[model samples]
Target: MNTSAFFEKRVGWTKYTMLLVLLVISFILDLIISIPTLTTTPKLGGIRGTSSVQVPSSDRIGMERVEIGIGIGASEGCMWYGKDDRQCRYTLSFQPSSEFLHLPPKQNVTKHFPDGQIMATCHINTALQAMVTTSFIFGPFFAGLLPFTMILLPITVFMSIFSAISLLIASGQVAYHLKYSIPSFELQWGINSILPFVVVFLQLVLSIYIGTLRCMMRKKNPPPPDMTDEVRLEERPRDNTLG
Candidate 1:
């Protein structure tokens, strides 16, 4: 059985099946990365007697109090509240300190003390909405039209490109924050923030492959003859036989 013949016989169902599988996998990965997790290192400062704060996942965006742990002193734990200049303060062992500093988004904030400074790092996980939209909305939309290869192929390719670009921008934003702002913070690519980028790239590759397969199938299987032409040809053969 020739490989091309095998694919041609089933109307390129194999390609469509593979496309669906890729889209599903991509959607899952996109969804997974959208969840808030500890994408960066908890400890931020390197100086002795400096406290290291671990901002919990929940406090990244909301007005909730962020729990902080001190590496030095006998203080058990502290909590940070608010991002405003005066509101950004932490209480360590019931000792209130107003030296807490807020940095730009995706960067770690710092707390000043006489001994040393403590840093709290967190990234804005804004890609969640985009990833979710791409995965749940656009992905399924294209997958549903897979049976119509002529329509599906171009749409898939276009969607794949669009999603890939969007993901790239998101990944770049995360990486920029991780690199320049968060000191001593290490971001795990596969586990933390790089999942969407990888998934989108995979989707793009799959879309291209599906598009190629679609073109090949089209070439192999010619379009059906026009109904009127087919009818005319059939009638001419019958008329000749009768004559």
Candidate 2:
């Protein structure tokens, strides 16, 4: 007797599951770092100490717009309340970190402006995140499903690069502070230091998984396509005699 077989194919979970987990981790890390803005001012109260910068408005509801400038010999830090382009009282008169002692050539600071030191940080960060995620999220899906890449490649690359930079900016922000040298210390502790390593590790894991999967996919032979036991039996030839 002879037999033949048939095999079925389906996309598996490893590729998508790993990416989903990574996405969750990345968002968690981002939130951990970003939430600082809401807490640090009150927490440290260094330059912005217990004070806030608000944009004074004629509107009955006056928004909290207070700008605090900190320095010893030169301006070391500044904080502004929620509004942009509006004026407010200084948050603090005291300088908190040793960096104030080393004063830069001309300490000029701005709390607003899309790219102004602070605002730029948020902008750069948003832009960068938009970039990295585009790639991280779509790269494998498109490559695996469509690979007609001229369409997705540029966009993915763009997002990947931007997100990479946003990640960098976040890292940079981690090492800075409205409290001056506090960032220097944070660079050693908390989620800041751990974040970079986590990103790198996840990226590597994603890369290796993608690489291995791609190689496995391209191997061509693919065990001659899964022959099923039922099919094998169906294809078997039978000889009849009364046996």
Instruction: Provide TM-scores for the models.
Output: 0.37, 0.37
Q: Give the TM-score of candidate 2.
A: 0.37
Candidate 2 Cα lDDT to native: 0.37
lDDT (tens digit, per residue) of candidate 1 on 1-243: 333333546445555556667666765654443332221221321111222334345646744333222221111223233322222122122232324422224435232122211111111122332343344333323433333543443454455445445444443443444344433224333342345456647756765675565556546533234454665566674444655
Clashing pairs in 1: none
Error of 2 at 81 (Å): 7.8
